[model samples]
Target: MEKISVFLDDYRKAPDGYVLAETMDECISLLYSFDIEHLSLDHDLLHKTRNGFMLVQLMIKEKLFAKRITIHSANSVGGKAMYNLLKQAQRDLILSDSTIVSLRPLPLHFFPANVMKHYLEVI
Candidate 1:
């Protein structure tokens, strides 16, 4: 299987070498279609309700997993929820033990889009 990196967010363009999915559905499609090497996600998507947490829930239910998952939402509460869900899934043995789950929140507002890129890279 071909390995790919996925960046899931609504307002920010993906970093270099990543395929961008602006919505949860698109991101889910990518997860099912590809061997995801790195999957970075934001909690608040274009659709308020169909956010990254829902996608994470579906992933847990379907056993759809990436090698590495990062919660990159600026919304600390939402991002923490998603991150905790993944970790809980891992603890419950639903997600792979080897799958790396990380949280690298980015402020996705009140700044140029490039700021996200720098924020991701810098911290």
Candidate 2:
């Protein structure tokens, strides 16, 4: 089986099976080094660097392909802007169409249905 490679920015926020990176460089390097099915980006990434953080820009610029990109951002402005920018980049061939998804907080009893749905649909 091909393992899913995930790049998670925040250690505490990261889900299982993710490789967390503290720096944008490390994150981008991991992104560049492999093909990933999913990526989790935190709003804190923007705090580390402007333009919605370096990793995002790197993914946008390089047009790094992924099955999905989930942004777990608390900052409304940054989150919305990042979502739009990612969409535009994809439209402009700066990113892939199947890449970039906005992650939403689910209820405790939701049973991760949406995540499972995405995974099943992808498979």
- Model 1 vs. true fold: TM: 0.88
Clashes in model 1: which pairs?
none
The prediction achieving the highest lDDT against the true structure is 1
Q: How many clashes in each structure?
A: 0, 0
Error of 1 at 92 (Å): 0.2
- Would you list the C-alpha lDDT of every candidate in the order shown? 0.87, 0.60
Cα lDDT tens digits, model 2, 1-123, are 353656444434445566776556666767778777776665565346633345667777777656777765556666666677777887887776656466543222343656645433442
Roughly what TM-score does model 2 have, to 2 decimal places? 0.70
Quote the RMSD, in angstroms, for model 1: 3.4
TM-score of each: 0.88, 0.70
Q: Give the C-alpha miss distance for residue 98 in model 2, angstroms.
A: 2.7
